[model samples]
Target chain A: MKVAFPYFGYDTIALKNFLEMLGAEVVLPPLPTERTLSLGTKYSPELICLPFKITLGNFIEALEAGADTLFMAAGARKCRFGYYHFIQETILKQIDNNVDFYPISQYTPFEFIFQKMPKIFSVSPARVMKSINFLLAHSRLIENFRKLVRQARVIDFTLASIHEKHALEIIADAINLMQIRKARKEIKALFNFADDLPENIIKVGLVGEIYLMLEPFANHDIEKELGKMGVLVLNNRSLYRHIKHLLHIDFDRIKLNHRAYKYLKESPGGEALNTVGEARTFIKNGVDGIIHIFPFTCMPENIALEALQKMSDDYSVPILSLSIDEHTSKIGLLTRLEAFIDILKRVKNQKAVSRVPRSSLLTPH
Target chain B: MIKIGIPRALFYFRYGEFWQHFFRNLGYEIVVSPSTNKQILEQGLKYVSSEICLPVKIICGHIEVLKNQVDAIFLPRFVELNHGLYTCPKMIGIVDIAQIQVGNACEILSPKIKDNFMLAHFQTGLKLTGNPIKVIKALNRAIPYLSHHKKLSNSEDHKQRILLLSHFYNLWDDFIGKDIINSFQSCGFDIATKEDLPDKVLKSDKGFAKNIRWVYERELYNAFQYYSDKVAGICNIISFGCGPDSLIGEIMSKQANEYKTPFLQLIIDEHTSKTGINTRIEAFSEIINRNYQSKPYLTK
Candidate 1:
């Protein structure tokens, strides 16, 4: 059976590798574009979040591309992400497109391992484990590529842009764990500064919905734009971290929980808690500003926005919260980014006179 | 008696009776905010973020009304009602929203309940009163009042039935949904609520429908699924900016089509007019009647 999944930056490469190893022909969904967004928008409920619409568009395109089996993450709890496959499947059925929809429950690893994966792929547990490990190792490479690119973009935009292409190529060609490790080193070396950076550069922490954090196309390539504007962007969200979270191997969540405790007591679903935690952490690290981005009408992130606004006032930090949808204008986004950067620059310049002592900014709150 | 403020919003509909009894048992006087009014709406608009739902906005108004008149506001942060089933993120973080809105005007008796529903509540109860024995006595005395909620089946066997699916806060609230519900009732339709369905019914096999995570949404889905064939039509009542209902409303609309039942999705907000709601209900009611008239044999 030809299987397909939604495109989520370089995570798609790792997923493609995993499915290919399972002996199934993998048909990648077309890259999310205006066409995909429009198609999804046309079919989706008017108020649904942007990720659902784009992912629906991905499924429609993937189905059109002759893939009879569509795989989407499933389980309806915590956030709306779990129930997306269900809503999208109904939409697809309305258009009379038929496909075997399999929702992989990311929450239930044990059930997925011994039963779900073996039954669906007709593969043994060992093969599934190896495929997952391969994906994890490859994701680490992808994460490294992103970190290197983040720094490289700020230091040298041309080198970062050129290296991103080479890194994507490197990730796509690496199928096994060992090959992924080798690719990681090569990819890292391509953009790795391996040195201390200049002190005057504005440091910005990017936090929000995970999809918006990882997928550049969804957020109109905000990272590249920031890099072009000469700001060093720090983003911790990635598929690799998500994979580690699923395995309960990531301790970042614990640290985030501890850090965000003063501001937000619980995970309000999605990455809202993470956003708040990182915002606090960012403040302590003396980041010039924090940029909170999420899909329009995203409940979790919207809830976090309240705390974010309060944090900005209480902590004397500048935060720009942008809600994106199909109607989000590129010009408007760019203008806001330019204005935000201008404000951050002004704020940085005046920090010496500002009441927030520089010494306290370095220490954790 | 220390007058405790209870916003006539959110879980006030779900657990209003119990809360009133619980607090009253401990010798504290309960002061409930008046139904949604113009002043509350305008006051709430000033404090709450615009992205939140109409119910939350109105609730914020209610809290604003109670800020000064009462001793403390009772806002519980509900994490989960079921395993893997969550209240919307909006509901989970409402304490923070209310806190922001009220500021230092009054003490907010906001209890954080992550899990273990009763114990968390009991802890809140103890916090209300230093004496554990008084809290235990109050809880035991309040249990009967909480259990007093019994949804009786509508006795209209001949009238056309329309399933009204909404969060309790929306449907039960007079200011929010009273107009639509009263109009439908006046129009002579038997309205079936999600509350009418037992909780276990939601967890049953729903065939190929996607696993709905939100507790209230899942219950609404099951109620819609269970009643689509049984009812004449379905009316999904949602606040204009509700995130969960926006998705579930679409699913319900689709499911209604499979059953060939007339479905009306009514979005209520600050801007929704009584006339507009009346016209839609009239149109929907007419369609339901015509639907039954077109197939008299199916009615029985």
Candidate 2:
């Protein structure tokens, strides 16, 4: 059976590899563009979050590409994300009657690995486990690539873009564990420009809903834009960290929650707690500013905004919160980014200027 | 006597009476915020970010009304009322928001009700009274009122009955819901809400709708499923920017189409004018009446 799933940023490579390893011919929907977004927005509920619309568009495109089965992730508590598949399936049925929709429940890893995967692909449990292991390794490789690209782009945007393309090719071509292990070193060597990096670089923490955090199309490539502005964008959310969270092995998450406790005492159920935690940590680590991004009408992040506001006042850090929807214009986004970067530069320079002794200022000619 | 304030928005429509009884039994005078008004809505709008749903903003308004008048605001963080079912994320974090918004004004008695609802309440009670026996007596006295279900008018008796689907807050709140209900009533139709249905009716399992994780939204889906055929039409009232209602509204509309039932969705917010709602309600009611007359058998 030819299977299709929504594109999840660069992590789509890992999921595609996993499905292919299970012996199902995977149909990758074209990268989300204006057409995909418009198609999704047309079919989607007017007020649903951005991820649902984009993913719906992805499914519509994939179905047109002759894929008969669709796999969408599901089961996030207290978030609308868990219920996306049920509604999407109903909408898709009106469009195409023959397509099969499988909601991959994110929380139930055992059921997913042992029962669902094996039954769908007619593969053994051992094969499913092996494929999952490969998926984790591949996700880690992609995560590392994202970090290196963010740093490399700050140094030299054009060269970093070229390296990013080549590294992605290496990641996509690696099918086995051995190839993945080799690709990691090769990708690292390609971005080895740490020695050339200047000190006292502008650092900005990027925190928000995981989908908008990872998806460049959704957030209008905010990281790349920030990198182009010569700011080091520190984004901690990735498929690897997300997988670790699901597996209950993310130790950093506990620390984050504790750090966030002063601002937000309890998790408002989405990544709101994480956003607050990560933002606070970034502030403590002396990041110049924080950028909070989420879909418009996103409940958890909106709540997190309040906490972040309080944290910003306490820590004296500037925060730029952007709520994105289909109507969000690239020009508008770029203007805001430019303005925020300008403010961060001013703040950083003022601090640097204030550090000099009064005698040195008096002798400055 | 110490006064406890209860905001007359959100879960107040569902559990307001129980809280009143529970607090009264503990010898504390209860103060419920006045019905939502323009001033309260504006007050809420000022304090919260513009992205929060109307119900939350209105609740914030209600809290603003009570902050100075009462000693403490009884805003419970409703996490999970049933097994495997959760409240909306906004509801879970509202208490924290209130704490940050109006912490210095008054004390917020927020009992987080997770899996063990009674224990949470009891702990909150113990914290207040420090008398376990008195807390148990108050709990026992107030427990029965928790499930005070409203009786649904018989659909067979009324020729033009419409199943009104919405959260309790939106349905019962005078300012937000009164106009829609009045418009329907003036149109000569009886309304049946989820509250009118028996608990057993709402709890009965349906196919995929049973998988809905949000407690109130699942109730709405179940109510729509049960009453779609039993009523002349379905009118769903939802606040603008409600995260859960966005999806639930879509699902219910699709189901209504399949069942050949007339469905109307009214999206309300702080800026929704009464005249706008009345005009839409008039058109909707007229359609429902006409459909009932022409295709009476179709409803069945």
Candidate 3:
């Protein structure tokens, strides 16, 4: 059976390789574009979030590319994400009657690992575990590459673009755990120049809905744009961490939820609590600001916006919230980012001026 | 007597009776905010985030009206109504939203509702009365009313029947759902709601749409499946930006069409005009009558 999954930045390459190791022909959709957005927008429910529309576009493209089996994540608690696969399957069936759909639940590792994976791949349980291990290793390489790229972009945009292409190529080519480790080392060494390029860049934490955080097209390339503006983007919700959280393999996930209790006492059933935790974490780490993003009409993350605003007030850090939909204009987004960065800089400068010694005061003392 | 306020929106329409019964049993005077109106909506708009659905904004408005008049306002955080399926996050987060919006005017008695609603309710009762014995007595008085309170069977024998698909709150709220129901009745049609069906039937295994995880939404979909043959048409009234309604309304429409039933999905927002809703309801009733007249054999 030919398998296809929605593109979530470079992490899709890791998922594609993992599926191929299970002996399935993987069909990757063409990089999402305006046409894909329109295609999804044309048929998707008018009020559904952006990720739903874009992923619907991904499924349609994958179907057109002769992929019969579609894999989508489902069952994120207290969020509409749990129902996306069911609705998308119905809509896709309306488009093509013969296609296969699987809505993998993010919360259930036992079902996904032992029951769903082995049944679909016709592989042993041990083999599925090994594949998961390799996938995790592979995802870490991509995560490390993202860290370097964040720095490289702030230092040298042209070099960062070149490095990004090479990094994705490395992830795509790496088949084994050893190769994955080697790629990680190479990606880190390639961007070592960025490590020493001064600590003057404004540090901003990126946190929000997982899909919007990972997918550039969904979030208007916020991280890339911020990096180009000479900002250090510290995104804690990398794909490696996300996969770990889904598999219940990460210890930090529970602690992150606990940390968010000050702002949000209960889990709103998505990464909303995580977003709150990350904002607190970023503030403690001396970050200049927090930039939160989520698809418009998103349930969980919309809840996070209010908490973030409250946290910003209590912590004395500025926050820039961008709610993206199909109608979110690039120009409007750029204007907001420019204004936010200016505000962060002004705040930073004011603090710097306040710390000056009495002898160094510009005024007649 | 301690004055306990309940917002006459969202849970108020669904469980206002239960809260009123419980608070009154505990000897606290229960004050329900007036039904949603222009001033309440405007007050809610002043305090709440603009992106939140109208129900939540209206709930906030209700709180605004009650904040000064009562000592404590009851706002329960509904995390999960069923074991797996959950209510909308806005409902769970409303307590937090209201606390911020309404400020410290009244004590927002919000108990986190998990599986043990009795313990939660008892604790909520204890907030008003110091004695645990009194809380138990109040809960005992409240539980039976909640359980034994029956829905009067609509069992309309009229030839033309329509399944009114919506939450009880939306269906009864004077501003929105009440008019749509009146329009159907005024047009000489029988309307059956999701509440009329047995809980067992509404919660029965949803054949293909098992992923519909909202508790009330599950009932709405399963009720439609059960009553699609019994009814002549399906009319769903949902507020805009409602996560479940926005998502499931399409599926509801699709199922209605597949079952060869006339379907009308009326979307309402704060800005929705009365004339538009009236026009849609009128047009929908006319089609149902026409279809029933054309095929006399299909009438239940």
Which candidate should be chosen as best, given lDDT against the real structure? 2
Q: Give fnat (model 1).
A: 0.60
Residue B52 deviation, candidate 1, in Å?
1.2
Displacement of the residue A177 alpha carbon in candidate 1, Å: 3.8
Candidate 3 yields a Cα-based lDDT of 0.84
Best by DockQ: 2
lDDT per residue as tens, model 2, A1-365: 88999988999999999899999999888888999999999999988999999999999999988899999999858888888988899889989999999999999999998999999999999999899889999999999999999999999999999999999999999999999999999999999984366888999999999999998899999999989889999999999999889888899999999988886777878899999999988998899999999999998999999889888888899999999999999999999999999999999999999998889989958
Q: Which model is ahead, 1 or 3, in terms of TM-score?
A: 3
For candidate 2, write residues B162-249 as lDDT tens digits.
8889999888888888888888887878888898777777766577567778888888988998888888899999898899899889
Which residue pairs clash in candidate 2? Answer: none
Q: Considering only chain B, report the TM-score of model 1.
A: 0.94
What lDDT score goes with residue B98 in model 2? 91
Candidate 1's docking class is: medium
Error of 2 at A38 (Å): 1.0
lDDT of each: 0.83, 0.89, 0.84
Candidate 3 stretches with Cα past 4 Å from truth are A362-365, B147-159, B297-300
DockQ of each: 0.65, 0.76, 0.61
Q: How are the candidates ranked when ordered by lDDT, highest leading?
A: 2, 3, 1
Q: Kindly report which residue stretches of model 2 are placed more than 4 angstroms away from their true locations once superposed.
A: A363-365, B149-159, B297-300
Better of 2 and 3 by lDDT: 2
